[model samples]
Target: MDRAPTIKDVAERAGVHAATASRALNPATRAMVNARTAGRVHEAARALGYAPNSAARSLRTRTSSVAGVIIPDLRNPVFPPIVRGIEDALREAGYMALLGNTDGDPERERELVAAMRGRQTDGFILATSRRDDTVPGSPVPTVLVNRRIDGGGVPSVTADNAAGVHLLVRHLAGLGHTRIGHVAGPRSASTGWERYRAYLDAITSLGLDQAAKAVEFAEAFTEAAGHAATLDLFAANPGLTAVLAGNDLIALGCYSALAELGRTVPDEVSVTGFNDMPFVDRQRPPLTTVRIPHYEIGREAARLLLERIGSPEAPTKSVVLPVELMARASTGPAKPQDS
Candidate 1:
């Protein structure tokens, strides 16, 4: 069997001391070696095909350079971009990401958290944090993304849902949408409550007490829930002329309900959604929504987690990313009453 290439082999080929070769290969020590000498050592390593054993290096450093990322659902379009951001950021930092999907179940989340902890992951980027969750007890550093925990001061990166909802409501009000309805997300999640409260605040601030009555809550962050909520809202208040959906999926549900009721978007009842997920623009009637930087939030969360892992004494932070309103085909001025 052929012996694996070694630093000595690289040094012999480059006509340099083995110690010099080792230093040249080490990222920390490379600057100490002359640039020309380092280049030569690199050439020799290439010729000898020397590859550092990451497993051995990790063992020696007592860190796996692996971060665990937990998501509530993989099927949610909002998560894919966020995961990409996390993976890209972690890869750039020479760390690996281990992804786990909890299907929005607390038990599954706890199980995944335990498995990740058992694997000796250096840290975690959790996108499934519930207000009552206990997963924050992990000894390793953790950063929440797109979610918040109650009383856990862990660092987090999340979209400003309240601000985004406020923007949406203000936009609707400016368009003369006095009879606006809201299809809120599940009450169990932070985004849900934050958005719901923001809706109330925005409506109240606009001095539209009647408009606030149009708000309804969905059972989950799914299209079915959105559809059911929209149906109930329409049944409860047949005069509503505009609807604010919790997310894009919920907005799609609104679309479904509108179709079943033979109502056209924008022309009959304008609808808006939050979280501008991919392909929303290409829908039959493009969704007007709040655009949260989902991917950037994930990337920033991973970056913060890595920083926390490196400097455990660093102060915890809560990063609130901004959101923008995307005016599209789904939202327009309210239809004329007589039309």
Candidate 2:
């Protein structure tokens, strides 16, 4: 069996000191050595096919160059794009990402955080932030993504859910939807409560006092919860012509509820969703939704986490990305009978 190439082999080939060869191989230390010596070391390493041990490199620098990402659930289609963005950005920056899914359980989240911490991850990018979290002692450079920890000073990157909800309400009102219904997400999440408040404020500002009663809350951010909430709203106010769902998955549930009631989308009842998840445009009635920059948000969160890891004393930041409305077949002018 052939032995693996070593730094000594590269040093001999380049006629340079072994320490110089090692320093040249490291990106951080490469600049300290003369450019000509570094070039010779690189050439010799390539010629000898010398590969540095990652474990040794980590031990030398006390940095793993890896970030831990904790998400609520991976089953949601919306998460895949976000994960891809994070991975791509990290790869480009010569870092790696470790992903952990908690399935939306607080205990599971705590376990995952502990496991990542044990692994000595440089920092964390968290997408699950409960109103009350028991996970004590976060990573030094942790950054909350898409959710904010209550009373915690961690930096965060989140969509402007309030502004997005305001856009949805205005769109519905413009389409003559005087009575708009809302299927609010779980209040335990920041996005949920923020969106609910935005809905109420928009309705009052639009003078849709008669429509305010149609808003209803969902127990969770799931299709089943959406379906149940939509049904309850329909029962309470049969005159509602439009509904703004908490998220795309919840919007899917609204579709099911409307189908069960023999109602047609946009023809009888218009609907709008948040977080324009993939394949939403290909639904039976292409869903109209607010396009939150999920992938961009993830990439930005990863970048922020990296910055925080580099400088823990940096002032914490709360980044709120903008959103846009994508008009589709699911929403249209309110039915004449709605009024």
Candidate 3:
């Protein structure tokens, strides 16, 4: 009773063979066992406080049982939930994460990748991928999170950007905003480019007013970049009644710009953002935006990377999750124009 509970003990308690108990306990192989039996085995293991010997498993498998996760910046509110999900998924699979923040610097990202590789990590999940990245492929199994490249040879998990953008445009149009401008993110990033492309398509298809000055690109995802881009967009298209920002941070910039230009949101001008990140609802006038499943995206990315580590020759796959539009106080019926 005093000794540490073993798999044998768990099996005995679960009323199953030790081999069945082993398979049921392992996240990778649990699918092969009967679902009811697996649940019983997990319950018995939990009751007995039996923890798998990860160290011995690593020795036998000749793997570090560690995944290297590289993200752009943890400062972004959207990424923390994602990282938490990744850690939870990896931990369930008896693996650990070696995390690094690249701060959107290519050199720093490369250095972190090399360092993690040297540590004998089992695989990698990167959230800092760019569309035009020219770097050679990774030596180990790799999966991208929240972004993808142009060719799409690698596995990745991302939100449905085009669908999300279309929802925003349609909502604004329903509000009678004929002149909608866009504060787009950097085109180098997949999220930015896809949203921008979708915006153009949405406007043309919806028969909204479109012009050369209706769009401006932010140098980065930061608020400062959004602020500058918004100013430029408004200066060139003063008649715009609505603005769609690439992300929540960028939307905050639009709020500041509109205020400085003496435009009241949802009154003189309506605004919407993407990524419905944390605390956006707490803004002066709660932001209307698109909500992507940040946590699920991370979990999916980790799951894909683990599958690749188990079977390296598997064909690459991409996962695009759904998104929702959150309408709030920031968007409203367009103001009436002077006759």
Candidate 4:
């Protein structure tokens, strides 16, 4: 087997001392060395396939060129784009991201964070923060994306969830859907809790408070949970003519449940989803949903994490972007069947 190239090899090839080659290869100390020397080191590195050992570099510079990205569920199409955005932004900044999935488990999340810490991640970009999370207590810098808890201790970048919920409810109300039910996600998640509360607020604001009896909570942000919660909602409120889903996955579950119950979307009941994920437009009825800037959320989260690492005392804040309502085939004017 071919031997792996080392810094010593780079130094010899570049005709410089090992320390000089190391400085030239590092982003921080590169400026300290002469530019011509740095250029020679770079040329030698490429020629020798000399990839610096990240662990060794971390020891010398007290900086790990690695960051951690925590995702909740990859099956949800919305997350892929968001993750891509983060990867793109981090790559441009010359940092590498290590990804972990928690599958909506707090214990799993904590374990993953601990493991990533053991690996010496400089910071964390967490998209899976539960409403009650110990992530705020992480020893390293942490930036939350897509979700946040109550305390403002950590930086966050989330979609305008409240606005999105309000828009979904308002659209259903405008369609004369007085008996509108909601398929809410798990209460443990801020996205579910906040959006569900907004759903209540929007319904009450429209004088549809009497119609809020159709609420059902999904066990998780998953199709199975969504289907189960939707079944319960329909059973409890058969008069419901419109349904607001916590997310696209839950919305899809609602679709499946409605199909088995022989109800046609936008005919007997109109269904609306949150987070206009990929391929929703190609569904049997083409979902009506609220579109959050998924990619921008990721980019903003990465940028915030980088900034917080640079300025640790910069007054932690949450940035909430706007949302847009997408009207489509899944929602329509209320049918008289509810009456």
Most TM-score-accurate candidate: 3
Give the best candidate by lDDT.
3
lDDT of each: 0.85, 0.84, 0.88, 0.87
- In model 4, which runs have C-alpha deviations exceeding 4 angstroms? 1-57, 336-339
Q: Which segments of candidate 3 are over 4 A away from where they belong? A: 15-40, 134-137
The per-residue C-alpha lDDT of model 1 at residue 172 equals: 81
Q: Give the count of colliding residue pairs in each prediction.
A: 0, 0, 0, 0
**In angstroms, how far off is 49's CA in candidate 4?**
14
Off by over 4 Å in 2: 1-53, 134-139
The RMSD of every model to the true structure, in order and in angstroms, is 4.9, 4.6, 2.2, 5.1
The per-residue C-alpha lDDT of model 1 at residue 24 equals: 72
Deviating ranges (above 4 Å) for candidate 1: 1-52, 135-137
> How well is each residue in 254-339 modelled by candidate 2, as lDDT tens digits?
99998888888989999999999999999989999999998999899887876676567879898999999998999999766665
Return the TM-score for each candidate structure.
Answer: 0.84, 0.84, 0.92, 0.84
Ranking by lDDT: 3, 4, 1, 2
